[model samples]
Target chain A: MSEQEFTIEALKQILLESAGADENIDLDGDILDTDFEALGYESLALLETGGRIEREYGISLDDDIFTDHRTPRALVAAVNACIKDTVTA
Target chain B: MSARTVITGIGVATPNGLGVDGFWAATRVGKNAIGRVTHFDPTPYPSQLAGEISDFVAEDLLPSRLLPQTDRMTRLALVAADCAFKDAGIQPGDIPEFDMGVVTASTAGGFEFGQNELKKLWSQGSEYVSAYQSFAWFYAVNSGQISIRNGMRGPSGVVVSDHAGGLDAIAQARRQIRKGSKLIFSGGFDATDLHLGLGRSDRRGRLSTSSDPDRAYLPFDAAADGYVPGEGGALITLEDEQTARERGAQNIYGEIAGYGSTFDPKPGTGREPGLRRAIEVALADAGVEADQVDVVFADAAGTPQLDREEADASSAVFGPSGVPVTAPKTMTGRLYSGAAPVYVVSAVLAIREGLIPPTTNVELSPEYAIDLVTGQPRPAPVRTALVLARSYGGFNSAVVVRAAD
Candidate 1:
């Protein structure tokens, strides 16, 4: 698999593992902007999501992720950037 | 007037076993809770053994909605809290959210979560990092998670006073009750996994590298080196006396009769005048003479200097006589914030069952001889137990637990 594909698959796996979302979480869909409850999760879900992604991808994130990436779309962007950086790193 | 507080419920997750029943049973038989580290590969790490509660799976406790957000320690907190609430005869929904509080402690929370995030950031690009990583492993996650889960709207606080935080959290809860809070779900939880933050500091010679469980935590013996760190602490539902009576809960385990805490002034100082003061204050608060304490629950930090300081303080208090001393922690290593509550729980059982579990690995030598209970367990009717604890670096705490009829 290309690094990009690996990154996408990895992010999906992380989302699936953490959120327990079986269906592919559409990175482009507005599902990105929903609160965890709306996305069917407790608020702590996002932290776990970020945690799982950091572990599998091997990255350190800034503190803002907790407050900055509120929407699903914002979260997707965050994940995408982490995945890209890890691939390059 | 200070309200009298009683422990109506207890929740425990530890290496000895899961839940209060298993934990109490294991210690009753003087069973060892130590084993080879499996949470992470230990092939290259200098330390080989730890009192690990790595068996817990979050799926078992969290609701489908909250599963993703609960960290391992928080997950354990939920389990223990549920168990304790049930034991106290109080359902989560039964209590008015505003009337209840949770005082939880963690030396570090979400450590595994943080470590993983950092790993991803270093090996992968910075873009790979997740912001949730920030709070996943902060020091306050335990209390935060408990409050969120139980919907407790009362006062909540976290303590980083090292391992002693467990007992101190309980002491803090009792203080809260005195100040008019109706209930408190209080305790501590910590996890030191295989990730980078997990074993690095301990492996840096902070942890005893002994492979044998029995020999690994010989607290107070002349050969003491260091303590092995472990996870899965305990919490109890502490309520004021009038409240417990109103609820008709009669099986009160014990009373949070008294607590004392003092700092050693500076880290790594052999001076422990502060430790002595803490003990004196706790005893004074309890209104009990030093000799009146049936047995002394020691804060046996396997560090040689700390052990000596504890022995000297204890000896000075009781005059080195027959006030039998035991540190059941030796069998399970040190659980940091998890240790004291587990010990306090064990002390309650000892009072109820009429047996004092022995300290596992000790063949006492001249340097430290305060009647260390070792090799075999002892039978004694304990009416009151003075539990002592000192945190890593330098926090000291003592609490008095008395038999509840």
Candidate 2:
């Protein structure tokens, strides 16, 4: 499958696997614009998620990706963009 | 008079058993948990026997989020902390967060976790390493993680004096209590896989190479060789007597009455070892005569020279076979930083139950002028107990526990 195929569902899976979803929050609900702190995903948890993504996709995620993409929607877009660039190059 | 410090709750993950009841039951019966190492392949190491918590599955006991971020030792410590809080009937918000503190001890830190990350950095390159490596390998991670998870914002610290650190951490917790903190979680735990490998490679001379579990770690025995390393430990919930009484704490285990520590004199100076002085100071601090101490939990190094030194020290303080001494660690091996705290747990339980647990599977040498309780549990009127521990680098520490009024 193309690296561009990275989706919100994939990001959801990674987030759950890396940091675990908050007990009270539902990941299936509308949470795209919600802050990570609200979802109980702190900086360290996001760093671990980034590490897993890089290892699985064979791509390098810039350290700033964690700060720049604060939610699943933004992180998914950034990962897809990096994958597209890697394929094109 | 100053407020007394008592241990209201205890949690343990030990080779022989888990939790206070499980560990105490096994210990009372002299159950042996040492065997061929199974945490990792022991074929490569000379000392094959170890006391491993063979049945512990961390995923079954802890939240999944914690598994990725923490090392095995930290997971065990967290569970122990949870058990301690539950045992004490104190929830996170039960008391003000600022009134609770954590003081823990660690010798190997996260050796298994660090070794795995270092392997990735070497063979698979640095990019393959996990981000958790930033703090997971630290010696203070146990104290830090316990405090963060429990929301304990009061005084916190980690002691790293090897075996002696267990008592040192308790002493530190007592100090925090004296400084006005209402409650403190203290003690330690160790995960011995990579640490055991390293010990075999660097200090194999001090580890038991025997394959038989029964004969592997016979401290004070005529056939004693060297100690078998073990994993797991205990975390105690300590509160001021007035606070526990005012809060109606269910089970007051005993009081952490007194503590003393000293470093051994440099070799060749002809100055005697400091173990005796530490014991004397602990007794004096407790304001009790040596005769008042009903039992002694010996350091029991399991090596002839070190065991002789400890025996001599005890004999000097309590007279020739004056006090009944036991090393329940024979069943669990030497747990490094975990040893002394577990002994403290045993001591308080002994005081409560009026029984002294045995040093299993050992024939004491007649040459040592000390009374070694062996083979079976000894029923006695145990009121005050003394626990002793010594580290490889000459650190000696002693703690006194007594029946709480």
Model 1 chain B lDDT-worst window of ten: B61-70
Q: What does candidate 2's lDDT look like per residue over B1-405, in tens digits?
A: 678999999999899999999999999989999888777777877788888897778888887668878888899999999999999998988989999999999998887888898999999988778788999989999999999998999999999999999999999999999999999999999886554453643375888888899998888888888888888999999999999999999989999998999999999898899999999999988898999999999999998989999999999999999999999999998888999999999998899889999999899999799999999999999999999999978999999999996
Considering only N, C-alpha and C atoms within 3 Å, which residue pairs clash in candidate 2? Answer: none
- Model 1, residue B349: distance off in Å is 1.4
Report the C-alpha lDDT of model 1 over B122-211, residue by residue, as the tens digit.
998565565556566787877777787778889888878867888889988988888888889888887764555445656446578787
Candidate number with greatest TM-score:
2
For A17-80, candidate 1 gives per-residue lDDT tens digits of 6766523344335554465455554455556667666665556666667577765556667767
The best candidate by DockQ is: 2
Q: What are the per-model DockQ values?
A: 0.17, 0.59
Cα deviation in Å at residue B21, candidate 2? 0.9
